[model samples]
Target: MKSLRLYGKQDLRYEEADNPVIENTDDVIVKVKAVGICGSDISRYKKLGPYVEGMVFGHEFAGEVTEVGSGVEGIRPGDRVAACPTFYCGECESCKKGELSRCEKLTVIGARHPGAYAEYVKLPAENILPLPDNVDYDTAAMVEPSSVVAHGFYRTSIKPGAEVAIMGCGSIGLLAVQWAKIFGAKKVYAIDIDDAKLEVAKEVGADVLINSMEKPAHEQIMDHTNGSGVDLAVESAGSPITSAQVFALPKKGGEVVFMGIPYADINIERFYFEKIVRSELTVLGSWNAISSPFPGKEWTSSVHYMSTGQINVKPMISHRLQLSEGPETFDNLINRKGSYVKVLFYPELD
Candidate 1:
């Protein structure tokens, strides 16, 4: 099988590898159909990795089941599925409380375990979410990322008529714009450095678009909110600058959700730190979505939205590359030389 394996920091190779087989009784071997490149994947490629050398690394993927282990039930061979990347020990207290993301024993695919950056990948059947026939592989692969946005919204306390400012226009940020509308946000501000991404944000549902590079994102958001800042501020850009902006873009006593993972030390100035203390703002940090009641409500909701055409992912996908183009594709995304969003990699050539 052909796979993209991590060699080291700034090194990813498209090479040959042995096909994965079912190792555990509940394991399922999937012939990977499509996989989406995530921001974390980019970080790993750039040497910001705890990634293992020679390990396959893609968590957002969908495929057809080719083999199923004996202990697995309900799911059979040939089932179209999108599997959750985060797996938890069902016996943990957190898992018992339906907080699968907080399970004491958590193993994430593409990080702690083998991932889907190949022709085939193996995972426990419990992680699989059976996809409807109407959902294509490209969209199915998107379920993982879309679920992240869904989970972010679930953690916030935004009311139906609340105003929202999503501080980024990346894939997750753009998705957050739509989720804000779906959740009945009356006004949404999509903030980014790129106008192209802001345009997409508007097409999705942003009532206001601000290029943070051209002017102050917080100033624009505050202006729209009549000097009171947005009711809800979601930080999805994961940069120090954006993180600082989100802290100052929420109304006093408003809610702020930190959905982005910062790669560097984020220094909050004394003014902003004092503001957080004085304003009584609720700050939340949301990690990967969980599998509550099995397979996660976020994943299920994303599937429902996608299947019903309520949340369309067609426009977000800007590039599709063959598996062999892994090296160049990573470079293109890293350099930001192309108009790209949600790049998908197809392992099998039709």
Candidate 2:
């Protein structure tokens, strides 16, 4: 199998690896189809995270089932599926309470376990989700990421006619823009320094676009909302600056949710910090896409919406390359040499 392996910081290699086989009674093997690069993948590649040396290097993917263990019923070969790569320790306190995402030993494939960036990958039957005929492999490859955004939205108390401000226009932010609409936001604002990304956000249903580079994002959001701010604000840039600035985008008593992982120390300014204290904001930090019954409704809803043409990822896909391009692609992505929103790699591509 041809796969990409992370050797160390900024070191990703495209090479041949052994094929994955069913190792447990409930195990299943999927032929690699479409795999997408994630922001966290970039971050982890730049700075090593919890991973096995030279492990297969991706998680967000969809593929055809090639084989299934005897115990794997209901799913069989030739099935098209999107997989939940998340793993939770079933006995952890959080899992015991039906909060699978919060399991003390929560981790995911492409980390300690081998991942989907290969000719074949294996997983337990429960992690496999069958895709409807309406959802193509490219779109199904995005289910994991879409579910991530849905999980964050599900944590909010957004009501119909509420206003929403998404403080980023990256893939996650673009998804947040659409999820805001799904959650019934009367108006949704997309904020970012890049006009290109903001345009994509507009294409995906954001009602307003704010180039935070022109002015502080919060200020522009306030101007649009009659200086009252929005009912809910989402920080999805994973940027140290936006992590703090997001506090000021919501009105007093409004909600703020942090979905992006700002990998550095965040120093909140007095102005932004005071919004949380003075406004009595309800702030939350949402993690990976799992919940109670394992992969949970986030995955189901994401697949459902994608099947219905609601959660569109077409605009978010900026590049589609073969697995062999992994090394150079990672460099170009971090070096800012090209327009990158979401980059998907097809393992079977020639």
Candidate 3:
């Protein structure tokens, strides 16, 4: 099997590796059909130090089941499925509480375990979700990241007719904009430094777009909300700068959700104090989804959303290449060249 492996800072190479086999009774081996590169993956490639070298690199994907372990039931060979990237031990306290994202034994596929960047991937049968008959492999590959945006919205308790301000227009931010609209937010303002991304934001139904680099993002958001600020602000840019912007854009009593991962040293004091002084702002951080919480509903609903044409992800896929082009794709993603939105790799392609 061929897989893309990280060697060091700005180093990625396509190499041959041993094909994965079922390791547990609950494990399943999937023949990869499609996989998407993520912002975190690019961050790792830039020497962020979270991803270890020589590890397979990809997490969001969908494929066909080639084999299933003995303990796997309700799923079998030939079933098309999307994978949940997070691996969790079902016996942990957080897992018991339906918080798999916070499980003590949580391990992300691309980050901790061998990931889906290869021709074959081994996952726990529990992590595989069936794809709807109408969904294609590319759209199904989006389910993992879409689920992350869904989890963030779930944490915010956003209601219809509420106003929203989203910072950043990257994959997660753009997806957040769509989810906010679908969830019935009355006015969703998308803020970003890139005009190209802002254009995509409009296509995804953002009510307003602000080039934060061109104007004051906070003031623009306030002006859009009738000088009251938005009811909910989601920070998806993953920067200390945007993190601060979230506090400035939410109304005194509004809610702010941090969907982006900031550096450990980023300061939150000003935002924390603002939350206390102004309208009682609820600051929430959402992680991955707990697939067990809804029993059989998690993957089904996400797939149905795609299958039914409710969520348009095709427009989000900007680049597709063979697995061997992994190095070039990594470079483009890190340098922010081209019009790349989401990059997919076909392992079987030569």
Candidate 4:
């Protein structure tokens, strides 16, 4: 078996590794088919710490079940599936309330344990979900990240015919564009620093594309909305600047949802901070997509949308590479070297 392991910051090595087996009676082993390189994965690869060498770190993955444990039911060795990757203790107060993301004993795959960036990975049977027969492995793997965007919508009060603005056009932000349109936004304004990403944003569903680097997003949205601003603003960039922009982009009495995780402390300007109070803006913070129902309704709805062709994940895919290209892909992602949108990995390829 071959796997990519992180030795240090920006240090990834593809080497031979032991094959995973069924570890628990409720666990199943999956042959890795497809997995995605997430933006956070690139950030962690460049950060100073939080590095764990010898770990296969990839949570957005899907594959065929190669082995099923004795206690597993309804799923077999040949079932094609994608996993939630959220491991939680059912005894925790948060878990008892069905908020697994807030569970005190939550362990996310790829972050805390070995993930699917290998030939095979072991997971609890309950976490494994069967993909529809029509969905391909690449799209099935995307359900994990897509669910994150879906959960972002759940935290908002966006209604049909409302004007929406999404800060940042990264993977999550671009997906947010699609979900906003699907969930009933009359118009969507996508803001990003990259022109290439803005183009993709337009293709997905963005009615207005504003290059924040070239001009202020708030200014553009105000001009387009006749100075009224958007009804909903979603902050998905997770930066101090983008977060502040989201705060100022909404109209009076509008709602702002922060979905991005800020890497550094954000200092909001006094004027921008006052906008929340003066405009009576509803400010909300959304963490990892967990609701009052375990894995949450977002996951189920994401799968349903993709399986039914109501949402398209193919256009978001920028590159598909073999596991051997893991190191190169990480480098490309860090440097922003290519016009890449989403990168997928196929472990079966050499």
Candidate 5:
């Protein structure tokens, strides 16, 4: 099998690797059809993450089942599916209370176990989810990222007819734009410095596009909202600047959800920090896309909406390559060489 492995920071190799096999009674092996690169993958590539040297490196994907263990039921070969790569220690306090995302030992496949960057990967039967007939391999590969955006929105108290401002236009931010509409927002604002991403956001149902390079994002948001600001604001840029700037985009007593992980220290200015106190805003932090009964409604709703043509990921996909291109792709991504949005890999492509 050919795979891209992480040797160290800025070191990704495309080489032959061992294929995964069913190791437990409930284990299952999947032949990778499509997989997408995540923002976290880029971050990890920039600086070493919690991964062993030369481990297969990827997570978001959808594929066909090739083998199943003796205890596996309701799942068999030839099933088209997407998987929840996350794992949780069920005995932890948070897990005992049905808060799986908050489990003390929560983790995903790519960090420790082998990932879906190659032709074959393995997971427990419970992590496998069958795809609907209408969902294709490309869309199914995006289910994990869509579920992540859905999880963040589910943590908010957004009501029908509410206005939303999403402070980013990356892949996660693009998904947030569509999720805002599905949550019944009257108007959805997409903010970013890049016109290309903002255009994609518009194509995916963003009602308004604001290029923050012209002015501060909140100022433009206020002008659009008649000086009132939005009912809900989402920070999905994962940049320290946007993380603080997001506080000022919501209305008084409105909600703010932090879905992006700022890997550096955040220093909020007085103007932005005061919004949290003077406006009595509700600030929330959302993590992985899992909940109570294992993978939860985030996964189910993401696939359902994708099947219905609501959560569209096609316009967000900027690059499509084979597994052999993994090394150079990661290099170009981190070196800022191309107009990359969302890159997907077709393992079957030679």
Candidate 6:
């Protein structure tokens, strides 16, 4: 087997390694078919440090089960599946309460464990969700990312016919727009500096697209909303600038969902005094989805959404390269030098 290991910052090597064996009673071995690179991967790729050394750098993946342990049931050797990136012990207090993402021993693939950017990946069978026969490997690899957007929407309680604005036109933001539309939002606005991303947002059904570079996003959103501000604002850009802009676009007593992972401290005084005091706004911070929670039954619903062509991921995949080109893909993404939305690496190829 072969694995793409991170030796240090900006250094990724394709190292030959032994195939992973089932080490736990509930573990399963998957022959990875497709894996997508995420934005967080770029942050780790460009930083200089041991923070992510020895890490196998991929989390979103789809594959076939080659082996299953004694405790595994309901899943067979030949079943195609999408592996959830987050791992939980299933016995923790949080897990017992259906909060799997916050389980005491939670470990995320590609972060705390050997990830999917390799020929084989080892994960608990409980973490694998069956992929529909109609879904392709590339789209199946998108389950994790799409699920994140689904989970975020679940947190905010976004209502049909409500005004919504999503900051950032990355894959997640684009997915959020689609989810908003599917959920019956009356008006959806996508904000981004990149015209290309905004174009994708429009194609995917965003009611309005705002290029922040051309005009102030807050003003444009207010104008569209009749100066009342959007009912719900989702921040997915993961930057202080865009994160701060969310407060300005949401109406007093509106809901703000922070879905992006900010790398640095964000100042929220205006959000505290102005938005919070004047309008009694609700600010919700959403992280990874709990596979066993409220929408537990909807896990399959998400797969169905993708399989039935309700949420198309075909337009999101921008680059597909061999494992040898992994480093270059990381560089291009970090530098924003290429026109890409999502990049996948095929480790099985030479």
> Clashing residue pairs, candidate 4?
none
Off by over 4 Å in 5: none
Q: Write the per-residue lDDT of candidate 6 for residues 1-350, one digit (tens) a residue.
A: 77888878888777876678988889999889889987777777776433457777688899999999999998889999987778678798988988776778876787778888899998887678898789989989888888888888887877788889999989889888988887779999999999989988998889999999988898998788888998899999998888777888888789888889878878865644486657778888877765575325435656888888878888878888887788777777778787989888777774
Clashing pairs in model 6?
none
Between prediction 3 and prediction 4, which has the larger lDDT? 4
Poorest 10 consecutive residues by lDDT, candidate 6: 290-299
Candidate 4 at 136: error in angstroms? 1.3
lDDT of 5 by residue, 1-350 (tens): 98888888888888888998777999999999999999999999997554788889899999999999999999999999999999898998999999999999988888888998999899999999999999999999999999999999999999999999999899999999999999999999999999999999999999999999999998899899889999999999999999999999999999999999878999999999999999999999999999878899999999999999999999999999999999899889988899999999998995
TM-score of model 2 (CA atoms): 0.99
The count of residue-pair clashes in candidate 1 stands at: 0
Question: Candidate 2: worst 10 consecutive residues by lDDT?
Answer: 46-55
The local distance difference test score of each candidate is: 0.85, 0.92, 0.83, 0.84, 0.93, 0.82
Task: Please provide TM-scores, in order, for all candidate models, with all chains considered together.
Answer: 0.95, 0.99, 0.93, 0.95, 0.99, 0.93
Best by lDDT: 5
lDDT of 4 by residue, 234-293 (tens): 998878788876878999999998878777888888878998999999998766665566
Count of clashes, each model: 0, 0, 2, 0, 0, 0
The per-residue C-alpha lDDT of model 5 at residue 182 equals 93
Candidate 2's error at 89, in angstroms? 0.8
Tens-digit lDDT string for candidate 1 (246-317): 878888998899888878888888767775888789998887888577667899998888788767777888
